[model samples]
Target: MPILEDLKEYAERATGLHRPGKRQAAELPHPRKPHVVRFRDDGLVPNHPRWPLTLYRSAVRIDERHDPAAVLEDLFEANGWGDSWRNGIYDYVHYHSRIHEVLGIARGKGRVRFGGNKGRIFTLKAGDVAILPAGTGHQCLSEEDDFLVVGAYPPVGTYDECTEVEDRPKALQRIPKVPVPRKDPVYGADGPLLRLWKKSK
Candidate 1:
């Protein structure tokens, strides 16, 4: 029998996972202000104090002609975010204590709850993007069957998912130290991320 990791890989491959179009089509995003929201550490979540979560609505153009995932993968790669993956959101509340994350919606729609229990819920659709600072809690509230998301991260941080109650202490210690990304995952060197985050600091 194959190892568990091999089995998972086989399943993903059989189901057509991580495959995007060969065409590279990412360009400038539509001009729009990133909607920013900050979350307080709710004991369990350890949300970032200085950087707020940023949301970009219809930031990129994803249409029927181009593979949506391909579009985002190119967009993110061009903006200096790498290690891209295509998938759906996790239903349970979870967060990354070490790395910041960027999620670009490729297909369908979903309602996602951000922050801890006191966090807000936002409906996301295709062409949308959400940038999560380190230690920010997020969960999938509801989603369409065809909902697909393209996720990537900045070059600076490591990726570690923290969910259980026991992950708090270290999360608190490490969350603040996650270095700010040099570029926005959506817009690039001149994007609003640099302005907003630096202004907050």
Candidate 2:
């Protein structure tokens, strides 16, 4: 059987058995923290204190049988992440207060700005992933015509849009309280996110 099909079967059986297990992807070397861009509070955006925004490049192997977004959704769900969605980033700036978010670039390329107006920007392509801690601001700067992204949140908290000054206080409060996810979205328990985030905290 093909690998993707085998994964699907394994997932179905695991679900039926009510056991927590994940089918492994092609293992890439663990990403180092220096590759990540950490955004801080820039007044307008109250970035998380305990968590930092992290990005992984060329993290997954891409091929014809797999849609990057679909693969990411499965990877995240296997790692105890939920609330997955398939879409592009919003044109305007926004942040989530109550939950951390992960974005996997499924196709094309795009430039995105993180950490409010003062934050740095990133150019991303297919197979790349970004993990945004709570209260980190992000905006879509530009993208290729075929651009697409998949997003999801950890299982701990509900998601809330925080786009105004009135939302700041509540957002600030919630950012630190959001617990680290049990497993890294793309690499399950052993992924870079677990090492980086746990060390930072």
Candidate 3:
């Protein structure tokens, strides 16, 4: 409920930014792991075992005429994903063992670190999107003043934050139970997620 309120506030605050605008549809096979990346962990990110992290560079190609945030929301919603929210990434490290998360860089730019304290950092800008498997750690390393991000999760279960060491075992149990999302957050049914994730399974 509180998250819903946050989402509402974010939407209202950006109302003028979502007006209809022309832009090209996202082109896929754009880039996958290594350059974009797939972070792995043993039991560090307990629930994140089977799925690899995914990042798409310049996935949407932003411009003054289009709203990257609005387009990302529509894509996730159409695919039955919910719990959408808009904001910058948290400055401190955190992860959710309950659900996979997708973050679209809607405005400005920022640097994010993934996979705990030893994780690498990547710079992101508008039109970039990151799909984090459940339990993977992420934190904002730096950002521009205008940085804004749109994030959403699959429409199956509620999410819980796990920043403490004691939460590991229970989080591990919960993560595997989370069903693989039926649609890719950005590319719908035929997206790269299925192929990439299926290989891991």
Candidate 4:
């Protein structure tokens, strides 16, 4: 029955039947300050040297009465992070060198390792969001069956996945050049993300 509902919901979304902007939309409550964590380049991972990964716990309100992934999509798009996808995190270790990403946990929970082999595992639950700077490594160590995340990128860069050690040499060169996001996916221009990233430079 749940899968059936999910199928129907997906169909409606694809057909542009479910999204109501400004009205009938799920409200996104302002979240607390994010917890910032930095990582060193583990050689293979090529973690960002300046910008740190940002984590927002219970950052959004996941309403069960409505499709939660849509809530994230709407919010991210509004904040200049567009072209979102609904899916689970990749199980294998990987990092993005061409662009930064924001992950909104729409449903369920997962233990995600950030910063490659040297990273820490954090349990992310519904309504949580993680803002990954370019070159930061991330992987899903474990997850709930219903785990779903809404991932989006800023307009500034392309989305490229780096999964192999062979990708390192090029990644190290490309990572530093990846443009930092101009807006925070959750809080727009006034968010702490812009401030932190600016201060890092």
Q: Model 1, 33-74: lDDT tens per residue? A: 899999988878888989999999998876666567767877
lDDT string for model 3 (131-157, tens) is 888888999999998788889999876
Reference-based TM-score, model 3: 0.82
Please give the CA lDDT of all the candidate structures.
0.84, 0.76, 0.73, 0.85
Worst 10 residues of 4 by lDDT: 18-27
| Tens-digit lDDT string for candidate 2 (1-201) | 235434654564555432223353334224534266677788878877766788888776666655555566666677777777777899888999888899988788999998899998899898888999888899999999878787888888888888888888878877888888888887777777878888887
Instruction: Kindly report which residue stretches of model 2 are placed more than 4 angstroms away from their true locations once superposed.
Output: 1-34
**Clashing residue pairs in candidate 2 (N, C-alpha, C atoms within 3 angstroms):** none
The true-structure Cα RMSD of candidate 4 reads 2.7
Whichever of 3 and 4 has more lDDT, that candidate is 4
Off by over 4 Å in 4: 1-10, 14-27
In lDDT terms, which candidate is top? 4
Each candidate's TM vs. the true structure?
0.87, 0.83, 0.82, 0.90
Backbone clashes for every candidate come to 0, 0, 0, 0
lDDT of 1 at 188: 82
Model 4 whole-model lDDT (C-alpha atoms): 0.85
